[model samples]
Target: MGLDRAASIADLRLKAKRRIPRFAFDLVDGGAEAEVNLRRNEEAFEEVLLTPRYMVDVSRIDTGTEVFGESFAAPFGMAPIGMLNAFWPDADLTLARLCKRQNVPYVASSAASTTLEALAEAADGNGWFQLYVSSDDTVTEGLIARAEAAGYEVMMVTADVPAAGKRDRDIRNQLSVPFRFTPEVVLQCALNPRWALTSLKHGTPNVANYADLLQSATSYADVQKTLITPSFDWESLRRLRDRWKGKLLVKGILHPQDALRCAEMGCDGVVVSNHGGRQVAFGPPTIEALPAIAEALGGRIPILLDSGVRRGADFVRAKARGADFVLAGRALAYGVGAGGRAGAERAMEILLLELQRALGQLGVPRFADVTRSALSDMPASQD
Candidate 1:
């Protein structure tokens, strides 16, 4: 089906599944262990009820929002996704350009398949960099310097992944960086000719940010070792906060205390996320976790929600529950995976339309007005 015919992100997801190899599809689609947290992320959003006020002037609903002192065309932006090109050829650059054209933020991942400089160029002023905080201090400091030189106004330091989640699908697929091209993988690629041909042309996606580090690094294991600082702690966060001159946000916050600590330690914002349910299988969904953090922070700083935001109403649900802004990785992932830029733009267009319609239904004029007050039931704070 064409981009216009794709009604929902689910449609695009199915389209992507059909077009890409199963192994590649599962790499993005699957989550850790039994993926209970993943399922809960979406299901929690379902349980959130909204109270709509009628007889109000809802004619002009403004989805435009200001976040971290920057104006955006919408209330949400594209979340960072690593190895995006592995799922769709050149998807990293595609989504970056998509955000640029759409006037939304694109958080460039430290692990993104394309170079940060290239994505920064594509995103222009709309780019924010998400850091993984490598074990090497120089590498970590160098990345921050690069982002600053590249004109990224914000750097989001990820806090959730101390160790990589063991995704069962990847294990089953025997997935390796630069792709091992085992018999099964080769056959799977052969079955999905479009993906196979496109991937062959794109070359195997690698850790582009670690080009110099990986020059001597022998294997994918060696490459993986160069990523993510496992000993990262509150001291590490404090030190990081001290160094970055621009706005800084701590991602992967679930508990209110952790959220409060970030705020106390001077983080510009906190992204209430479960790492898209990829970090832990039993963690609370981001939606379920937002109210407490909101109550704790009491709007001291901006709050951004990441993970499981598939539709425009989901963005509304997040806003009503308590997110100042929100971000989603898989919408653009599904978009690019389905049909590159057209598919991504279609997905974004669908969300923008959905958000406008949802605001109209809620009798709210602007996304900024969407708060816990919009919740049908003013329930007690959630832990």
Candidate 2:
């Protein structure tokens, strides 16, 4: 389907699946073992029903909202996605540019294919940086300095991934960084000529932010081992907050206690997430976790929701459930994979239009006007 015909994020996902190789698509599309949380994330959103009040001034709708003292055209922004180039070459850059043009925020990942500086330049300094703590304090300090130098105002430290999740799809497909051209991979690449040609022209994707550290790492295992710090904890967050002067947010927070602790530790915000269900299979969906965390924090820090936010109603549901803002991952990833920059823009356009329509339908003039009163009872879980 053409970009114009792509009415939803799901449509973009279908297009992306056809455009990219199976292994590459699966890396972006699949969640952790059993993917129960993955499906639950979307299912939970459906449980939230909006109650529209009629006879109100629904003519003017504003999707705009302020986050971390920065104004965004919409209440949603691009979530940080690692190895973006695995789905589409230069996908990180594409998303940065899209967010800049759309007047929204883009969080560049520590494991992005493009460097933080490059993404910052692409987003015209509207980019936020997501950091994965390193085993080496020096490396972590260097990354913080780079982000500060690049002019990123907000820094998000991912707290969940103490260990990597077992991604069965990736293992089955034998997907790896610096992709090994095994017979299966080679055949798959050959089958997807467009992606293959683009990838070939752009060269292999590497963790651009960690290029210096990855130099000595000859294999994917070496790269993984050198970068991930299994000992990441609250102390690590305190150290990061002390060293980094920018706004600090803790990502991958599901428990309300963790969110409360982030507030106690002086975090600027907390992203209610489960690493997009990539880190845990049975954890509660981020949507299901947001209200409790938001209540626990009690507006002490801004709460951003990620995972399973696919449509405009989903965005409204998040806001009504107490999220200050929502973030999209696979939505834009699928867009870039489908048709590069234009596809990315298309994805943003669909979400914005849907958001406006949802706000109007719910009799909410702006995203801030959405509240728990606008929602029906939460749906009971099937299982």
Candidate 3:
């Protein structure tokens, strides 16, 4: 379907799958292991039924909200996506500009194909940085310092990926670095001329932020080994917290104890994510994991939800289930994959439109007003 006909994030996904090569699409679409948690992420959200409070003056609806002294046009924002240009040439800068225009937070991934500095400038003051926490302390420190120099206010450290999740699709596709041109991949590219031609014009995306270190690496495997921080622990977190000197957040938090400890230790917030079901196959869906984490924090920290949030109602469900705010990576990636900038714009339009309708339908004035009281099928916890 054309962008004009694409009405939902799912439609965007379908268009993307048809537009890009299998290996390329699967890189964004596939999750870890059997992808059980991926399916669970959306299914769990679907099971949450929001009940309307009816008879209230629902003539007006405003979805605008704020986080960390920043006002967003909507309650949600874009999460970091690594190698974003692989989906569409210049997608990283495109999305950063999109976030600026949309008045939402734009997080630049450490592994992004575009430099953090460029993304920061494109995203303007709404830019945030997400760290993968390299095995080398010097590299980590340099990245931290560069982000600060670029004027990033918020820095998020990923906690779930001590080692990379074994994504099965990458294995089957022989998805390797330096753009492996298997006959099948070549054929897929041939079929999708728009993606192929654009990719040719832009060149293959790489780990732009880590160019210095990556240039010295022999293979992608070596690159992965050098980057993965298996030794990162609470001590490492404390050290990072001491060094960043910005609004710090820990992403990939599921356990309540971990969330509470992060709050106590002075983290500005925590992104309650399963890495969009990409990191852990066995972890609980983020929606189901939210309440206990919320109760654990007890309003001590901001809880941002990520994973399988496609529709606008999904945003409301996440907030009602206890997320202070929500973020989506694949949803936006699907947009770029479908058609570049216009596709990404459509994704945001679909989400914002759906979000406003959801709030109005639920009779909630704003995102913060959506409490667990909106929940129906899953009864309130009788604490």
Candidate 4:
């Protein structure tokens, strides 16, 4: 009943689905194409089998990890999600505060409903801004300057999403950027009065990250056109790195060559993500790609991972395979959507506790010690 007692992200996910409108819920829950990738993401996590060892001093374990020169309380952090206000009034602020209290890094989306300065201040020094390259270079420059001035510790440039994915749920539910609910959607909103009243009291959500570059689009159609650009290139990444003083991370990298390219380009890190199965219809899950990418760029740059990370063991799998750090997007969405800051906090607590237990069982004292050699894939055996 209480927030701290929450056991799983699924608990929060159900709550979020109930509180948020159908369209809003679908945006966070649904993925591109036939949703095969989405299902595979979660299934991939379940596929990893851990061999635990006993008779070891497993009384204590440490999950703390340092990335981009800053120590984090855990090996994982929250990945940035767009249109956060759709879930709660000020979802960005909620996540920022929670990240501070939890001491895990919070990456703010470029399409979030809160301003860069506001989130940076709210998150204190734990904020990391996720940048979506704009079509205009001048706009991009200003955004870089804003994040630098806001005291963000890291600047993560999202290199995926050259164009918006064709999410069938969004189309069916009529959910877009500003979220103009159709009559059916309006009825769904009315059914969830708590969400409707709170949303009304706070005023409509604005695209805060692009507040200066463009006016906030009030409809789904308007927002889609403004949110993505197909022309985001290597030059854009170089320009962003040049302007931002903090650690620069490139998100949405899946290719091993691309991971090496980021290292060669002087990027600080690369998040091997398939946009949590939201963008591409098919690809190797982040876990499958972790080892190769990490092996290629292990000493060069921090290899961060996201996608299908539902529980603590998933983190172990990623770390053992090659990831320096892990991140979760939908799980936090489930948390915040389920019960605001308390729910989000519960999600982190659940992860940390589970991770601690997992570390002890695996005969590792430190989370980072669960390295590549600690794991061996199931081999073909005599039947």
C-alpha lDDT values of all predictions: 0.88, 0.88, 0.88, 0.81
TM-score-better candidate, 2 vs 3 = 3
TM-score between model 4 and native: 0.93
Candidate 4 C-alpha lDDT tens digits along 161-258: 88888888877875554445568977987998988898899888777877654565566555655666688888877766777777888999989999
Off by over 4 Å in 2: 378-383
17: Cα error in model 3, Å: 0.8
Q: How accurate locally is residue 272 in candidate 1, as Cα lDDT from 0 to 100?
A: 96
lDDT, candidate 3, at 372: 78
For candidate 3, the C-alpha RMSD (Å) to the true structure equals: 1.7
List TM-score per model, in order: 0.96, 0.96, 0.97, 0.93
Each model's backbone clash number: 0, 0, 0, 1
Q: Which predicted model would earn the best TM-score?
A: 3
lDDT for each residue of candidate 3 in 207-255, tens digit (9 for 90 to 100): 8998877876766677776566899899999988888788999999999
Which has the better lDDT: candidate 2, or candidate 4? 2
| Candidate no. 3 TM-score | 0.97
After superposition, candidate 3 runs with Cα above 4 Å error: 377-383
Worst 10 residues of 4 by lDDT: 374-383
Query: Which portions of model 1 miss their true places by more than 4 Å?
Result: 218-221, 379-383
Total colliding residue pairs, candidate 1: 0
Instruction: Please give the distance, in angstroms, between residue 13's alpha carbon in candidate 2 and its true position after superposition.
Output: 0.5
